[model samples]
Target: MLQELVLDVRKALESSRPQRQADSSFDRIKSSFACQFSSVNPRAFLPWGFVRHRTSKWIWTNEVTQPGGDAPIGARAFRKDFTPPLGKTPAQADIIMTVDNGLTLYVNGGQVGTGGDFRFAEHFCVALRPCLNVFAVTGLNAGVPLACLPPSKSHTPTAPPPLSFPTPLGAIPLRWTPAIAQGAYGVAPWGQITIPSTTPVLSLTAANWIWTSEVVNGNAPAGARYFRRTYYPPTGQTVTSATVIIVADDAYSLTVNGVPVGSGTDFHIAQTYTVNLAPAPYVVFAVVATNGGTVNNPAGLLVAVEIMSQCNCISGAYFISDGSWKFNTGTSVGFELPGFDDSKWPAAVIEGP
Candidate 1:
């Protein structure tokens, strides 16, 4: 009878031990689940319900400055001002803005739109005036103060495509050809060269040209300067194409007989300007140039004009740049007109032999 009682006691202890083990295992599983779900870091894995589809391309600012713990939790204000191009109608203009967590956008002191939540980026399109536009954004950090967690390997994004591509268009234009249509899907082969259909009308070396400026030789003044030269066309010469290759230290705007033709902002590369000139007694070429404002940067303008004259007699007669050019320190009203007076302007000094 004693032996039987000992066996019963042993069975009771074994049963209670398993129950205690199960309770301990249950606690461990619960703790793991909570740890996986509780993350405040942006790079950490968020629940499927928290993920959202982006509406547009993300345009991050060049300077990213995330706030520290001591910073405010929400409602930080940022303002930027921009001037739209002149003569752009309201129908042709729109503005878009976004921030890290949430923001409210404003244009010209008027509230355009607002967005909240970190999942979706903020985007807005509004008619803009041609004048100075004031843009303001208020961003909020919607992060929960919790322990940071690691992103799960299963939720990592797949590898991106080799070619650059944007979001697909809802409707393709009707004018798209088969090759062009395939390009929209980012299927174009890498390093493919696109040959331009139009041929260059005129190409000439700068051997017959002179780099010149109105200011002291080799020192470019820090403001816009005007340059002008008159061309007298030979009568009965039918000019088919007229092209000018120009390069400046900072920027230049070209005009032919009071009509703007082209402008260039790049200083490293030369720009080409082409215009069809009707048969006229005279053609006035004017360029408004500005120094780049960087000290020790070479400041000069080089130009080469090429005109296709049907008559061989006038081939090289009027299409050349020389010491006949004059320049002034500032812009003048109606400076591009053929009859505009440049008598007071100083003769341009040759920059190079």
Candidate 2:
């Protein structure tokens, strides 16, 4: 297969420039890497629900955040191991690949290519080894939401067999899979590596991190900052479930309609909670964020709330810690109640993501 790839490229160079071809395989490639989104050029990618071969799907590690999910910035390792057909090694093979933010690609432990801007795909050509071949990638997600499309395929002029594959994000400390991050399913990150313990809830992606105006340059007044936000159930309907994630710089205590829900201290790891509101026509979410320190220091709050209304489970209401929430520097014991008057309070400040 590698030999055929080499001959294919060699013949193309020997002859006039080979026109780029677009077939089922190429169409799949374009759908994933041609642009940052299929919406950018509808004709450049496959339509939604288009059945595709399982051999190709986007994959990532469990640690890699999906679009809108936040995490400590870092990189994860992935590998694809395969043995090409026995024959004289190919002189060269051309492959194309792309990622959401950036990637450093390696083959047999050697760096081959790197791409940062996901808006455009990249092309790479390298010599193939006669024995076992390994394709490894170092995927870097600078911030929220990241994933790598499955790497490119190698084709021989005479034999068009694909040469490399299996890409997905793992939920574990490490993960590997063949085309695991299919775009249709909210595109799970990092292949099959699912570490639910570390996975941030999906709804958080639609929310934001927020705090009071006292927070400046990520440093807030060294004291308590009160926050409250309200949500109303659909007219003539009630809500049955609400899921919320809260993270504060130092500590936080969350409440729903004046009832205690949950709390957390370490801001590095977000805490999630579910509250029942089966009979309520409206709801209020409250939090007391404490930036514990003698002087000003880094402090902020991030909360993501989601609820499914009884009228239509498909219709959801989301509330993030944002400017819509009111804040008070002083304490108020019953601030979380649905009838609490917060109209005079200032809106919460928006800290950086």
Candidate 3:
């Protein structure tokens, strides 16, 4: 019995390396954490769990309320997902199930057990992943006149940590945890961002056209260049709206917090664009400008931005494209993201206003 238990654990413990989980994947490494599993019983491990007798309802493709009902003699696939809370620790899930004809159980994409008898219920002690976990079942009926049964009886497991898996067998494309029901600040599922009936229009000024080098002093190599300027609201103040004028020597695309807004091509004409960072803590402006000229041709970018958190944007504070902006040649992965590090990139050079 002990040997069997060890084998089960070994099988459960065996899992492919976890894929990257989103939302907080690239968050600065503040610290690391892992679940300290108790030396005793079942927990979210991998592909292993214990099985016992527990009754559950059978799911029929054709409304087989009775075992003798005219449900087709074929296989039906059922899936549900459970997600644990986002925390440093792991969690355990105890499950109970029964099947009329035959059923195979897959957890988080791995087979756990199979049952052929509806008389003896199959109880499962499942360990959950830190992220989403899926429970998939395939049931088959051989046109038998027995009582119908599904896989597990829907029940919330006891928690040293926590368990909140909902069984929605018919729902495909399952996810382990509940969806992030909220959008950005002042967005839907939370509340609407209050836009004042009389919103003040902001303008751009006092910032020079800048790039890797000054036009008269140096020339930028052909191809593309990246530039970024980030703004933070004063402590306790939230940004309501913002505006900027962007211009480049050739062509450019601009994004605020990874959302693309507009672009400009002619350096002689700077396009005014509105930025809505309602209740903003901070915002980043990313620009990728391509100079279609040859290697020795000059390229430059000019931007002037005004952010309003207060009635008059903290008394007219403007961030412009200048030496404070970070710059890099060609393309760098994740450069558009707010958390991306540009500390190693050199500062942009001031060209002309």
Candidate 4:
């Protein structure tokens, strides 16, 4: 019969090899064919309903504008490599990325990250095995508005002049102890001092002030140096309104007693410089800082001088002679409260509501 049918097919393939090695529990089955058969590098296996078509077009806004406008999409000239091809390293593989609404993320080109505006619709992800990675993206709309698309034209309407604060304003009680040129407001020179402005004063000095510097043993002078101070507003006060701000985190330069009104090198944060004074009773506000001198470490300078009034109290209050009340001096700085009544204060409270 053909040698008994080859010995019954070799005993039925040895009884199916121990029932396929006792079913091997499907190797803890995590589907996708267990990462496409546990990838021994079959091109790192990626096929199980595979359908990837990642396309990035860039150049959105033929004109219908307003969805997140800032204008300027794709190729504003920025793409030094746009890398993304490394499997296993952000600790050991598994990466993700998403972008769709006015993106802005660069890696080799610099940036690093940024979100979208107006509603939502823009995603991001990071974690690419540690090295060998580059990404590029850029898109803007600038504040959209081109009249419902049609080629794209209309764009020329500058209007930003509505920030008035006029009154017979007066509020001074800014203190910072240590500078006593002669004691009781005479000699002065320890750090922080401001109290001498009273007249018809429209906006003389009550925006607050605090500055500190030290290096008395090494002969000072290491990097920053600029100062000024002059004030006289009393004769029917007339600064109308002025603003010179600073939160200083690094560099500085400002003047008034001798001119030069504004100068900043890298000083971060509260920055608002606007000065057009002619109705002077006595206006002099100067600030020269380099507290980060001896190689930068914890120097100081926190300044503010905003004045714009025409009456007495258009609802103002930021007290701290002990009563405690605050609205904004950066959270009443260590305890003198009395601010928080500028008509309920909350334009996002200052810049973001």
Candidate with top TM-score is 2
**Total clashes for model 3:** 13
Model 1 superposed RMSD (Cα): 29.9
lDDT of 1 at 17: 15
Candidate number that wins on TM-score, 3 or 4 = 3
In candidate 1, stretches whose alpha carbon ends up further than 4 angstroms from where it belongs are 1-204, 207-217, 294-297, 310-320
Decide which is better by lDDT, 3 or 4.
3
Clash list (residue pairs), candidate 1 = none
Candidate 4 stretches greater than 4 Å from native? 1-66, 73-223, 227-239, 243-254, 257-276, 279-286, 292-295, 298-353
lDDT of 2 at 281: 68
The lDDT of each candidate is 0.43, 0.54, 0.52, 0.29
What's each prediction's clash count?
A: 0, 26, 13, 50
Models, CA RMSD each: 29.9, 18.4, 24.5, 29.7
lDDT of 1 by residue, 93-152 (tens): 122222334555444445544443232222233333323334444444454210000110
| 85: Cα error in model 4, Å | 66
Question: Taking the tens digit of each residue's C-alpha lDDT, what string does model 2 give over 1-353?
Answer: 00000011111112222334446876745533432221211112112222222233454544424542443456655565443332222233343445556766665555655655443334344444433445666656567465544432321112321223222211112223332242422234433221111122434543567777776667777888889988765343366777888888899999998888988989889888877675786788889989988899988888876665543112244446667788999988678888889999998877766
TM-score of each: 0.39, 0.44, 0.41, 0.20
TM-score of 4: 0.20
Question: Can you write out model 4's per-residue Cα lDDT over 321-353, one digit (the tens) per residue?
Answer: 000111222322212111212333222111101
Q: Which stretches of candidate 3 lie over 4 Å from their true place?
A: 1-205, 213-217, 278-280, 310-316
Cα-based lDDT at residue 131, candidate 4: 28
